[model samples]
Target: MDATELQAISDTLMRIVTPDMTPKQLIKAARKEHPNASKRDIARAAFFSIIANADQDHGKAKNLQAFAIAERTQNGAE
Candidate 1:
């Protein structure tokens, strides 16, 4: 695959592994914690991380998304 395709795949995989972090939060946290790393690179890593932990159910993604949305709503109310 070309660099772009490979990067896209990498990003998706990372997200699958890190089911806890929303894509937006992952980008922000990665930038702050790894200042030298490109947001795109960090995102790709996170995606790969998720893929590594994936299962047939994808239950993790569903649960994480629900939790993230609820957290955002809770924080917004404060």
Candidate 2:
């Protein structure tokens, strides 16, 4: 997707996400909201949203890190 679409997806995910929710939960919710989006796209949006939140609040950094690790592991990335 393009930057605008990515940002829109990220914004939607940010609205639906909660601090207590896991990355898988977030992806499921995002998929429900955006049925046409690819799983990779949803994860990328979540990553960007979490990173942006981390930039504004350092407390979110751990969530971002955890999500990143989970995403990489799920994708079979090293």
Candidate 3:
């Protein structure tokens, strides 16, 4: 997806994200509003959110950054 779509997804994520939520949980939440949003799309949104909202919430940004990294790595994920 392009930057605009990523931005919109990121905005949605920022609204729905909770402190204890996992990446999987975040994706499921995001998909509620964006039915066609892929895992990759959500992950990309996490990354974008991290950058755009870095100065807003440190904890939230950190969580999103972790999610983005998890998406790109193998880490024996199932």
Cα RMSD for candidates in order: 7.7, 2.6, 2.1
What is candidate 1's local distance difference test score?
A: 0.49
Candidate 3: 10-residue stretch with minimal lDDT: 69-78
**TM agreement with the true structure for every prediction:** 0.37, 0.71, 0.86
Query: Which candidate would rank higher by lDDT, 1 or 2?
Result: 2
> Candidate 3 lDDT, tens digit per residue, 1-78?
888888889999888887888878988899999899888888889888998998999888888888889887844475
Q: What is the lDDT of residue 16 in candidate 2?
A: 70
Cα shift from native, residue 31, model 3 (Å):
0.4
Off by over 4 Å in 3: 75-78
Q: How many angstroms is residue 47 displaced in model 3 relative to the true structure, after the best TM-score fit?
A: 0.4
Residue 65's lDDT in candidate 2: 52
- Per-residue lDDT over 8-77 for candidate 1, one digit per residue giving the tens place of the 0 to 100 score: 5444443443556565665565455445565445444434434554464366545444444554565568
lDDT of each: 0.49, 0.72, 0.86
Clashes of each: 14, 0, 0
